[model samples]
Target: MKLRNWLTLVFAAALLAGCGSPGPPVDPAPVGDVQRPTPAGTDMSGQVDNSGPAAPECNPRASLRPDDTIRPGSTMDDIVKRGYLIAGVDQSTNLWGFRDPHTGELQGFDIDVATEIAKDLFDTDDPPIRFRAINSGQREEVLKNGEVDIVVRTYSITCERMQEVAFSTVYFEAAQRVLVREKSGIQGIADLGGKRVCAAENSTSVDNLTEADPQPAPVQAANWTDCHVLLQQGQVDAVSTDNTILAGMAAEDPSTRVVGPPLSEELYGVGIPQQNEDMVRFVNASLEGVRQDVWRARYAHWGLGEVLGNMSPPRPVYR
Candidate 1:
């Protein structure tokens, strides 16, 4: 099957099969055979660093002017003229961006955000929108190369990333946490000092996990579902990333649970090309509208309210 078509079937089958009932305990060990990199300590803190060199780092917020611009001759106009919004997103993060296995349809919270963006851009929720499934590593490339109009994946806004592209105001907030089997005896991230851990390639979790004081031997995968497979197969001791992603993993594997507290604050933003400041403002305006009610309905529709609690959406700020 093609990559996109295979994604939903592969993940849904794996998770559903693995989560049916309790499984045997796992004995995690140091993963020495996997290709890995050195730790960067606390330097790659995954937060926006304003103290860096004097360059135009991306502002965490979009223009807060009550009257924002999304007029003709802008990027928004270009997209409108094109008659469709090409979005880069994930297809296997479950509640965040997974495809529904049963229905073979794309659906998730991030997917909903894309739908909303399309709805506002073309004045109809049925607006032509296409989804391209990209992994953590492809988030920046897709936008930089003009492969997509915007990226709504669980992309964190960082100073380093800001140097490469632009971001709208935060639409959602997440925290990095740990996911381990129920009987893994792992209580938190601190306990994974010498154990092998899995994180998505080119992701903040990789640097964060590697930077642990004692440090975990890192295993890289293309998606959280890959990490989920490794943990299920007892190939890795733990997996770490945003709690939202981990929550999906935990839901898939009944024997696994999200352990440990938050590792870092992650703000999810709509990634636009550096030249599309107008598009950024338009997306920010759309986000403001969604914050009023769309997010609540989305959260409920995905049944994510229980795992994430009552989220009121992130407040908007200007650069």
Candidate 2:
């Protein structure tokens, strides 16, 4: 046989030898291992300096007195003319300011508090308002940048923070505490000596941890929920923050519980731009009115009494 014919016959035999009844196609093995994603700005390793000159001593709870007079061209006047109040809020902090999974509507004590302000501003039960969701670290930045007219998130008042933005009278007081798995053998902050604990970056919780006597390694996440994720994934041994936040986390995961004595007293206030004194006073006045009735009702509505006990709103103090 010719060489060409011989080669062709060999190829035909090879094809015939390989042919068989075909079955369902099989997927190839995955190329790489899947990794659960952490939220943006998560920092597994970061250091906080606790040695800074003790932030200029001032009573963080004291703020300007309530003023209902909205002068022409002032911040409140502008907001009134705009027809809708823009508020910065959180959507993942559970009872404080979280989204309702069933209705897809934002509902929480903080949301209600912000809504009360809007209602009074427009003089209606259903006021024109818009809620802008933001992370814990973005509270001051949003106010300073004028991205939001007011930040009603769990924004703690601090002397350092006061320099950049203004605050309304204290609205809620939360205590810093620790959250750990029920059976993690970690009973309190004393037990967290060398363990990794998670808190959102730029939060006062990190400072508390770093300033502790036997400091546990502090890991920073982008949000409080991200800290919860770290706790669940075993990336961190505990999550520490405000009691209100820790209570929400415990409610979300029954396997965990808040432990330890309070690390610090955190006084939350409405964040406003330094230039917007009129807005601050207006919000203070709104808060003053809310404390009379709406605050207590909303606190009970969010079921906070079960976790935080029946509590009254913090009284406003003027400087």
Candidate 3:
């Protein structure tokens, strides 16, 4: 079989394997999960939106019900019963969650989010988290089959995805954007006429860029890093992806930079299996903690201020 065909087959088999067994149902209860306030107040009114549509206000409290069977304090019990907090993530998306060459350990923004949840459950700030490297298409399936307890792979919360998985409140916000060589003179998506643009296969970035006005040829790469390699080699004029991922790429390559404004805005939510309300609530609370206590610190440590601007301390937006 061809290489692309082989990869497709492997991904299909992984999804099939992930659908065999449903994990234990979440407990229903209104236990007091800790709620930490965001350091900076949320003001979406002033937030810019260059992407497809503004995010609808989702009710975080709706995911938490007072009559829920599982009480708040049961988060640890659930994980202990399950043995490990199996987190599905992308090991190739740098700055979010990638395997470090020196340590052979997964590290990034998403990894930190998972670590926070593990800490909340184990009462240790640095609890060990087992990661299952997953592709964009495999995230929901991994959660469905109990292959992973949570997915923190820069997943965007969409109505369609909600049908298959429960998502926590918006922990991090990102936008679809373009990245180009500093000397390419490509200002934004509008400048891509007749230019070759690359995006990850099976990603929303491909769909969005392909449907743009000028309709530049959309090349598919196995991952964003692969797409960046193509761009560096002059195989493509520009590469497009989430702003966070693109920023990380730019950090690695001084010759590259993110161009123009964002094309679309998206919210990053932690993925839990659908109907796992207890787990959803618990994870939501954990996200609130990250947004308040650790988000800004990590962003600065990761040098994200250049791309994200003064939004280092994320403001909470609960509806």
Note the Cα lDDT for every prediction shown. 0.82, 0.88, 0.76
**Worst 10-residue stretch by lDDT in candidate 2?**
45-54
lDDT of 2: 0.88
**Tens digits of lDDT, candidate 3, 1-319:** 8999999999999999999878798889877966433112221121222356444655432344212234545644677666668789889887898889999989998998898988876666667678999877688888888788899998887765676788877777788989999998889999997677877665667767766778777776666777787788776789888999998898889999998777777778889888677787777667777877898898887777887776743454543
True-structure lDDT of candidate 3: 0.76
Candidate 3 local Cα displacement, residue 50, angstroms: 22
Give candidate 3 misplaced runs (Cα > 4 Å): 1-76, 312-319
1-319: candidate 2 lDDT, tens digit per residue: 9999999999999899789657789999888976777667888774665666667889999999899887889888899999999999999998988899999899888898899989878889999989999988898888888899899888999998998999999999899999999999987889888779999888899988987768898989889999998889888899999998888888889999888888999999989999989888899999989899788888787777777787899888998
Give the RMSD in angstroms, all C-alphas superposed, for model 1.
17.0
TM-score rank, highest first?
2, 1, 3
Whole-model alpha-carbon lDDT for candidate 1: 0.82
Better of 1 and 3 by lDDT: 1
Worst 10 residues of 3 by lDDT: 38-47
How do all models score by TM-score? Answer: 0.80, 0.88, 0.75
Worst 10 residues of 1 by lDDT: 40-49
